[model samples]
Target: MLASLAQRFIALTLLATVGTAVSAQTLSSDQRVLKIERMAHGLDIPWAFDFLPDGSVLITEKDGDLLHLAAGRLTRVKGTSKVLDQGQGGLLDVLIPRNFDRTRRIYLSYSKRLGRGSATAVATGQLARRNTQLEGLRDIFVAAPPADSGRHFGSRLAEGPDGTLYVTLGDRGDRPSAQSLTSHQGSILRLNPDGSVPRDNPFTKQKGAQPEIWSYGHRNPQGLTFAADGQLWSVEHGARGGDEVNLIEKGANYGWPVIAYGRHYSGLKIGEGTTKPGLKQPAHYWDPSMAPSNLLVYSGSMWPDWRGDIFVGSLKFGYIARLSGQPLAEVEQIRGDETGRIRDLREAPDGSIWFLSETNGALYRLSR
Candidate 1:
C-alpha cells in the first residue's frame, strides 16, 4: 500500500510538471514593453517577495531557499528549513511585519511534510545575522493535520490592518471537502499572530466548524491582500478556465467547484453554473483563463495612471493584468506580452511595482 501511494505521488508530480510546461508554451502575446534583465540565475522557482526597510528584498524560492537581494546582488540566506516541495506546494508567501524595523520579525508560509503528504504552516522568526549569514530560525503557527493528498493546500498569508493573520487553504483536490465545515481545506482561516484562533471569527461559535475559519468554499486562492479601503481582495485559479478576482467579506462563501464560471478538466460542466442564492459572485473573472497567481492593488505613485488599479500576475499568459474603474468595471491585460511566467507582483515602499518570473527565475522593477 505504501509503494502504491508513492507511485501515485510520483505520477501526480509528473502531471503537474507537464501541466505547467503546457501552460507556459501557450503564452505568446507581444504587448509588453518591459524586458526582464536577469539579476541572478540558479535560484529555483522564486515564489514571493517582501522588501525590507533597508531597501533590500527577501525572496522565497518554492524549493525552500531564502535569498536576500540587495544592491543588485542576490545572496542565499543560510539556515532556512527544508520544505515539502511537491506539486503546488513549497515555500509560499513571505511578509515583513508592519513594525519590522523595530521588531525585526518576519512571517512565512510553507508546506511542511507530514507522514505521507504535507500541511501548510506559518512561522514568525527574527533575522539572525551570524558571520555573513541570515537565518529565519523558528516557527510560530502550524495548521492542523491534512489528509494524504498531493494537491491544493492554498497557502497564502495576509495581514489585516488590525493585525489579524488571514491564511487560505486549498481543497486538497477534493471538491467535496470544500463543503465540510470540519475540514481546514477550502477555507480562509483567521488567527492571532501567535497561532491562536480569533474569537470573532465567523465560525467561532458554530458547532462542528473550526474556529479558525473566517470564510469557506474557496478552491485555491493564491493571492490575497487588503486594499487601501480596508477591503480584502483575493485572486484564485479556477479549474480549467475560470480564474477569479474576488472581494472577500467576512463570513461569506465564495463558491468553488460548486458554482464556477469554468468547467472541469475533463470538459464537463462544474456545479450549478455561477448563481447560487447564498454564494457571492466574483468581482472579476477570466474565461479562457490567465491562471492568475499573485494580486496587487496599486496605490503607488510611480505609475500615476495605474493608481487604484488592481494588478494580477498571470502564469498561463506570462503577463500582468490591471483592473480598474469605479465599481471595478473594466479589466485590462497590461504587460501580458512580457517575458516568461509572471508569478507574483508587489508594491515597493517607494511606490514602484516589483514582479517575479517563475519560469526564468528573474525579478523585475516597474516604474513610470
Candidate 2:
C-alpha cells in the first residue's frame, strides 16, 4: 500500500508543536509530497533488520525469531540463541557484517538468560543458505553483572568507519550503575569485528574499568547509527521527559540520571541540574519525551534534498522527526499509515528509507 502526502501531512501537523529548536532549513509544503510503501506486515515488534547484498533482508523479532524476508515471503532462520522474550528483553538487534559477502557472518544482540539472571549479549555466527540457520554461534561480548530486571537492554549495533562495531548497552534499570566504571551496563562498547576488544579502548588502562567500554553514562540508548561523515550517534530515553540524541565520543561520559533535562518521573528534579562538571550534554533533547528509538543521518538518493539531514524514529509520538544542523534540532515530523511506535530505521542500498513499526507490527519504505 502506498500512502499519500496529504494523509501523511495531516498526521504530522496534528502532532507538530511550536517550540522545537529550528534550523535554517525553511519549512515548505512542497517537500511533503513523499510516499510511504508497505514493505511487510504481520511482524511481531520487529526490532531491527539489515539487508544483504542479494536484496534479501534479515529481521529480528523480539520473540526470538530470526526471519529472512525475500521475494514476498518470510522464512524463519534457525539456530538462533534462546532469548528471554520478557518485558523489553529478547532478540533486539541484527546486523550484517561489513564483509558479509565474503564472510557470511552476522552479529546479533539479545537478552541472554544465563542461569537465574539475564543480560544483553552479542554473538556472531555464519549464515548458511542451505539450512537457513546460523552456524558456529559464539558470544563475543556480554554485559557484566547480570540483572533480574527485564528493562533497558539497549542493543543497537553500528559499524564504525574503522571496521570495528559499536554496541549500545543500557544502565539495566539501575541508575547508579551508569556512573560506575566497573559495570558494562549504561555504556557504549567498541569491539573488533571478531569480538576482540580494540587495544585502544578508552578505559583500557583505567583501574577497575571494562576494556570494552568506549563511552559511559547512558540511560537506555535504543538507536545507534553512523553519520555520513562516519561519526557515531545515539538516541536514548530519559526518565519523564528528557529524551536525548547524543554524538558518541570516545572516552566521553554521557550524563544520565545524575544530570538530565528530565525529571524523576515523580516530578522531582534529576541529578545536579542539566549540566555538571565532566558530563556531556545531548546534541538535541525532547522536552516532553518523544521516547526516541533510533537515529539515521540520511544520505539516501531518493531524498536527495535530505542527503545530510538527520532523521530519528520517535516511538512515543508515532512519527519520524526530520532534524538537521549541528547540535541537531527538530525540523519536521512525518507520519504515515503504518507509522506507529517506530522501532528502527535504515537507508536501503538503493537509497530508500526502510523502518520497522512496533505499534503497527509492520515494515515500511519511504521512496520517491
Candidate 3:
C-alpha cells in the first residue's frame, strides 16, 4: 500500500464550508444477515468489475488476466497486455463503457512494463468473444514519465457523466515529486476516452504541470468514482496510517508528504502538521489505515437504503467500510471476519454486491 511496498478527518477551519454532503443508511456491520455466495475463484487479485449488457461480468486480475464470467462460465480472454506485476503493480482496473453494446468497447488500466519498472497505462479496444478468448485490443492512454518503482501504482479508472475518463496515479514512491508540477506522480488525471488531455483541464495552461492533472498532492489513490451528483471521490493509502477518503476538485492540492494525519512507519511525525494553507483536507480518514483498494458510490436499487453511500474495500482490515455524512464521514464497517482482504467491490446489475478477496483468490456476492 505504501511506496515502500507496504501499506484524516477534516480540520474544520481548514475545510471549505462548501461541498455536497454524503448520505448513507444507518446499517451497522453486524446488522446485515445477507448471504455471501462465492461467485468465482482461481483469481489472483481481481481488481475491477463491470457488468455487460448480456449479464456477463468483465473482471481484471492484477496478474494481467482479463476474465469474462457469464452464467457460471469463466473465460480467460486473450490479448491482455503484459504487466510488470511487481510488489503492488499489475493489470488493475477494467471498465465497460456505457456505449458498449454498440461500440463493443471496454477500458483497461494496468502497470505498463518499462524496463524493470512500470507506469500506469490505459487502453480500450473492441471486445469480441471467440470461443474461449478475446480479441481486438488497442491502447488509448499511457502515463507519462514512467518510473521504475514497484510500489504505489494508483491505477483506477472512472467515467464521468460526459464520458471523460478519470485516472488516479500514485506518487510512484517519489515523495518530493508529488509537490512538483512537472511530474505525473501523485495526481488525479482527467483524459478523453481516446487518451488526449482535455482542453479545460486544471493545469492545461500551466507551463510545467502535466496537462492531464486535475488534482494534486495525492499519496497513492487506489480508487476513483463519480457520485450521483457528479462529484468525484477517491480513497488512497497512507504509510503507517492516514488512509483517506477525499472529495476531489479541480486544481485542489491534497497535502500528502507535506502534511498528513498519519505518521511515518518509523513512528515519527509527518509534514509540518495536518492542516495548511491552500491544501485540501480529506472528507474522512482512518488513523490505523484500512489499506483501501477501491471505492464505489452506490446508486443501485437493490439496497435502497444505500443510495448515496460509499463502499470501500479494506485490504488491510479485511472488510467493507461504508462511509456517509453531510460532509462525508465513516459510518460503519461490514463483515470484517468473513470477508478476507477485500481488494475491490461492485454492485451488480441485479443489485447484488460483488467483491473480490485477494487472500482467497475468489469473488463473493452479497444479497438479501
Candidate 4:
C-alpha cells in the first residue's frame, strides 16, 4: 500500500510542474494575430499622430507638413507654420486639447529657423474648415531664445492631468548644455497653455535655473506619456546599447553624459560609471539596443489581456515590444508587419492601435 501511494504522489507533482510551464509560455507567445490595415499613405516621414473627437486623425510629417485623415481619405491642411526643415529638424508632434471637440484647438511642436541655427517651438492653433482646405490657422506660443542645433532637438509634447503642457528638448547634440541650468536643451519643460512658465514648476524658484525646466539630464527623450498610475514615463535612446524606460519625477536629474549603461558610437566609454548616488536609474534597459521611438500604455477594452501592458515601437528591430511590471520584463514581440521605421504609436478612441511608419509615411491600424 505504501509503494502504491508514493507512485501516485510523484505523478501528481510532475503534472503540476508541467502545467505551470505551459501557462508561462502562453503568456509570452508571439502568436498574437495582429492585422495591419493601411489607413493613409503618401506622407513624408510621419512623426506623430493624434485622434480627434469625431474619429479623424492629425498626423505630422518630419518634413514640416500636417495631414488630416478622416473616413479613409487624406487632406493636406493649409496655414502650416514655416519650419527649419533641416536634417532631423522639422514639425514633430501634434496633440489635441482635452476638450478638442468643443474648442477645435490643436497644439504642435517643431523646429523653427532662427539666425544661424534653429529652436524647438511649441504653438497652439485652431483648426478651422475654411474654403476647401483645413488650416492650422495661427500660433499661440513660440520659444523665446530661438537657439539652434542640427541634432538632439527633442520636440515631444505631452499634456498633463492638470491641463499644463509638458515639452522635452534634447541637448542639441551638445553635451555641456545638458548640465547648464540656463539652457532649455536636454531638459523636460513645463508651461501653461499660452507659453508662460508655471509657478509650480520645479525650478521656478531657483535664481539661475530656467523657470520652465521640470527635469534635466536627458539625452533624446522621444517617448513621453502618463501611465494609469498618474506617473509620467519617458523612453530615451541610449548611445549604442542602453535604451532606457524611466519613471519621470519632478526636479530629478537623470544622468546622461555623466553616466550611462551605453557606450559611445565609436565604442568609447561614456561619462562616469553606471550608478551614481543621486541620479535616478531607469526602470528597465535594453542591452542589445531596441532603438525605442514611441511608447504607449495600453488602456483599452478591445485587448483585455493587454490592458496594463506598455507598448514600445522599435526602429532598429522593426517590431512592437510589449513590457510589463515595475522593472519591465519583455512579454512579447509583435513582428512581421510593415518592416518600416515606426515613428509613433497611439491608441485610438475606438481601442485600436495605430502606428505611423516613418519610411513609408503610412498609417497602419492594428486590430486583433
* Tens digits of lDDT, candidate 1, 35-76: 233333444688888888888878888978777766555555
- Per-residue lDDT of model 3, residues 61-115, tens digit only: 8778787776555666778888878788888898887888888888888888876
Q: Residue 121 lDDT in model 4?
A: 84
Give residue 66's error in model 3 in angstroms: 0.9
RMSD of each: 7.7, 8.6, 10.7, 15.6
Q: Which candidate leads the pack in lDDT?
A: 2
Candidate 4 lands at a TM-score of 0.88
Q: Worst lDDT window (10 residues) for model 3?
A: 7-16
Q: Write the per-residue lDDT of candidate 4 for residues 1-368, one digit (tens) a residue.
A: 77864564355334333432331111123556665666766566788999888787888887776777766555557667888778778899988879777767788898888888788888777788531243555555555455556787777788899888888888888876777778888888888877788888998888888889899888888888887777888888888988888889999988887878989899999899798989889888898889888788888567888887888889888878889976678777876546477889988877788888777656777776
Please state the error at residue 211 of candidate 4 in Å: 0.7
lDDT of each: 0.76, 0.84, 0.80, 0.78
- Model 2: per-residue lDDT, tens digit, 285-315? 9989999888888885776778888788988
On lDDT, the stronger of 1 and 3 is 3
Clashing residue pairs in all predictions, respectively, total: 1, 2, 4, 3
Give the winner by TM-score: 2
On a 0 to 1 TM-score scale, where does candidate 2 land against the true structure?
0.90
Ranking by lDDT: 2, 3, 4, 1
Which lDDT value does model 2 have at 231? 85
